[model samples]
Target: MSESLKNKTVRGVGWSFVDNIASSGVTFLVGLVLARLLTPAEYGIMAMIAIFIAVSNSIVDSGFSNALIRKVRVERVDYNTVFYFNLAVSVLLYVLLFLASPSISVFFKEPELVKVTRVIGSVLVINALAIIPRTVFVRDVNFKTQTKVSLISSVSSGAVGIVMALSGMGVWSLVGQQLSRQSLNSLFLWVYCKWKPSLEFSIESFRELFGFGSKLLLSGLLSTVYQNVYYIIIGRFYSSSLLGQYTRAEQFNMIFSSNLTSVVQRVSYPVLSSIQEDPKRLREAYRKVIKTTMLITFACMLGLAAVAKPLIVILIGEKWLPSVYFLQIICFSGMLYPLHAINLNILQVKGRSDLFLKLEVIKRIIAIAPILIGVFYGIEYMLWGSVFTAFISYFLNSHYSARLIDYPTMDQMKDILPTFFISSIVAFFMWCVSLFDISAYILLPMQLSLGILLAFIIYEKLRLPEYLEVRQLVCSLLHRKNKLDNKQIWTKN
Candidate 1:
């Protein structure tokens, strides 16, 4: 409610937007370069280890970092406790990852993983060192500094990746890029924020934070496990090349969804935490967030799904053509990832993590495991697995959250139905266009503009008042597109 906090919130949102643009842009560029340079098979090997590494890393933080953020009564010493706790976990993870690397290689029948996993696995320590500084920065909403640090680190990592890929380092190029980014981020954070821990641990402080943290940790672990289980299952049964293709397709499709949702998640958590007490006001904010998220998130995923073939061909080259269906399938499913994430965070903020835990267990079974079975059946089945699991998980999470927030499943569905109908029509129409070989330089924009314009027209025609408010929101944004559009203009006179 104070002026300082309001400024901090605004700064956090701005920082998130900038960080998403800079980091996602850099990642997109470097990823394109790597995709061009490395074979899908090589990327697949990395994907396999990524599954292991991601799950392990998620467990390292679980949800405690968020718990630290949301906890209202945190003491100054609580910061160090969370830091030490994360540090201990990171060290233990490194040892475990190193020891387990041989078995991982043996299990996957890829002996190279023994070395590769251990090397990439060192990021656990780097990431752990980052937790406290990031936590403190986020706890206070110092997004401007965070964004600057992130931009530098992202650009640096991208440069590392490109050079490594050009030098024929293969998979290690990807590994090196990741390691450099994590190390640089830690260094930046340490320099940017003057918060160092004493050699101290407080059980009491830990206990205070743990109340909120246990829920976040459980939610985080389950969430991570669910997200990556497909890779694990696929890598176990399918060849690394196939996994690599699928991973690329999936990752490429995720650019908009992840960038947008991650921005909201990082920004919303602290914002929502600060406004947790008044259920009416909290619910209002939640409604707007959910609606806005639905509008962009579904449209993004749907657009990507409609153009999976061309997108894969254009961006990743003909070598990865096999991933077209995989991309299309996963793109549709990923739309719901953001909503599920935000809704789950509501439970996290309300201190009703018991609900979150139960939801996670069901979600893994309903959403994750079935997809693994889809791989068991056939690769074509992977697409269906994605669609089916998304429906089930979305409905389930929406239902669960509706109880607490009192916003029904239909309300959420109502917001996106326009997107659903518009996307379907565009997809059907685009299918007719795709029947021939139209050059993407012409087709991509034609389809994109058509889809967007059609959606806007339809939304205005039917939901004009609602769309007007959204337009106002956009115009009111501090960084408007018109400014950028005019930034590089020339005066012919």
Candidate 2:
């Protein structure tokens, strides 16, 4: 990789991590407050309609953002075309969802979902307005600006949600949070990104981008639906309170799996795409990414699983204790997610959206039996089923990456195995620590500190290159910042 691209990737990853930390921290704290103030049934109500909103959001972009990012040189008309197309689709989708709200309520046997669905569905339209600018930022790898946008939006909206929840807004507090965040995020993106849409709408541009984007659209739609299938099944078959517990478990698990993986996936895609022509460099970069991602995420998920009970009780209180085992079971599956994401990102970087769609279909098909079987048995069965399916999906996601770049599943597994082993050892030690006679308030921080210290010691002793790379990058960033501060002070003097 070129030095400029490498530098950009490093900077992008740093800013993305900062963005994830800020946004997720705010969301986590706010969720803790809301969980105490509101009942599980209230959370379950929002979970019931979450699929509709997610599917609508997918339809709005339809993978055009990926298409734009993949293009060698994006034209003004391309942006204008996608902007208008997304806006039109989002509006039509909102209208359709608005009309279908009653049917949704009837299916879930919850009449309150009708209004909640309509209100939250509006986020699709609001989010569509910012697609072009967000795409531009991603393509340019300008995550510093993206960080500011996310932090402001999350903090402001989280505060609003907290206030409303405390004031007894109940389920509407969650709705208010969603709407406010999307609205403010869009507003801020428009303000920070000077890109504006023109009156130019080219059918040719739309068709050209759509050719590549359509496969991604289908793939994304399938993936979104499948991911939300659990919520659908749980809410429909079981009590809303049960669904709420499951949602809470997933939420806590995602704080590690999704947020951190997003940082790697976002930065790596554009950076890898820039080096797509060189298979050797691409493979090397891909290997480094997967290794580093697994090193961190594996350790996190395992450690979280070990401390799940104490963490939940301390953070969200004993009311959410029922989610403890669910969270622990789900973390086992969550550990594989970063692997799945990085492997799939290779397909997009190689402009192989067709394979992306194919893999999605096959994986979902393979996943269905386990999902159905788990649902039939119970929620615990379903959670264990997910753990089984996650490993299978990782293998499936790795197939195309092997063909395209010669980085086979076994080879990838071999790369991550050492880190996985170390993480397991550390998690075992932490679990032993939890068995001690101690209060959760003291145990939680003690477990965290021990995990971090053990992870660093093992990585250092093992001479893990990814750990050293991350350490060096962080030191370099801090060094550069200190130099700049000194330069500014000298200039003032």
Candidate 3:
């Protein structure tokens, strides 16, 4: 890859940091408001609707975004073809979702889900429309426009949701917010980009894109099925309250996990696609990406688990105390989420979609059946099943990463072992601190401060390249300010 490409990737990631903060802030406010406005049953129904929407979303775009970005020579005709194709599939998906609404409601024994499913089903189509235009923004590395698009969408949705919540619209508020965001954002994206599609279809171009799309489609399908199966199983077997509890916990876990992955994956995939021919540089880039992703993901997840009670108590309410355990388990399950995105991108860039799809399919087959069986025994067993699935899935994900780098599975583990080990040891000590006869207010902050201090100290002691980079950044800013002042003084003289 050219140095300019690397610089562009760096700039993209830097700009995306602002997008992340905007998204995080809006989501936090909306989640807090909605959690109070809606009940567990409401969220449970929304979760089922969310599952359908999410799974459908993964399939709707035909992975055209990735396919377009990966290929060296993209055409207006091809882009238009993908756009029209995705629009067609998205319409079909909406119809299918609407048709499935009654059955889905019956499947869960929640008749009210019919309306909810149909309402959120519209978003599938809206999101599909957004894909081509949104990808256009990212293709040329114009994250500034992308950031504005995202911020406007998020803030507007949050405003609409708050109003709906006040008017007793409940779940519809969230549904409307999502649909509005997609609709408005797609409109904006179309206006921002110069590219517009013609009503043209090419069989050859379709095959080229679909060949990649099929693998991503399958991988996405399995991953989606694997994820929703958890909620489906829980909802089918347990009460709405329990399912809602799991859903809330999972939602919060994903808010962090998805945001982390999105921030990095958005930058990583395009960059990887550009660097597809060079293995060594790609591997090095992959390593740094994984390192930083793990450092952040592991810390966020474990830290949340460590302070689960306080967070839930402060954020939700006392009624959600049962969810604390589920939240903790989901946190651990999500620990590998952010870092694994790079591996997925590597597979996408290498055009190994078939292998990627097969890997996840095999994983779900091997992983899900046992969990399904375990749940039949009891809820406690089900919880254990979740914990078991997470560890095994992490290993499976790493298997793909290992194949890419010609590194051993354990060596892959070795890459993240330091953070894992340090986080575990620190969490254990903090747990010890929690055992003391003091209020959580005291112990929580104490452990939070001390544990962070210890982690930073250990990280500093290791003196990773990132540590030196940070130090240099601070020094450079100070030196630049001095230079500016000196230049001004010299001009005055």
lDDT of 2 by residue, 1-493 (tens): 6788778888898888888877776788789889999998999999999898888889899999999998889999999999999999999999999999999999999989998998899899999999999999999999999899889999999999999998999999999998998899899999999799889999999999999899999999999998898999999999889899999999999899999888887898888888899999999988888888888898899999999999999888898899999999999999998888898899998889999999999888887986787668888988888788899888888877899999888898888898899999999988889999999999989888898899888888878887887687789788877998999999999
lDDT of 3 by residue, 124-243 (tens): 778887898888877777777877877888888888888998899877887887778778788888888888888788889999899888888878888887778777877777768787
1 against 2, candidate with superior lDDT: 2
Steric clash pairs (candidate 1):
62-217, 63-216, 63-217
The segments of candidate 3 whose C-alpha lies over 4 angstroms from its true place after superposition are 1-3, 436-444, 466-493
Better of 1 and 2 by TM-score: 2
Reference-based TM-score of each model: 0.92, 0.97, 0.90
RMSD of each: 3.4, 1.4, 3.7
lDDT for each candidate structure: 0.79, 0.90, 0.77
Flag regions of model 1 displaced more than 4 Å. Answer: 1-11, 462-466, 478-493
Poorest stretch of ten by lDDT in candidate 1: 484-493
* Candidate structures ordered by lDDT, highest first: 2, 1, 3
In lDDT terms, which candidate is top? 2
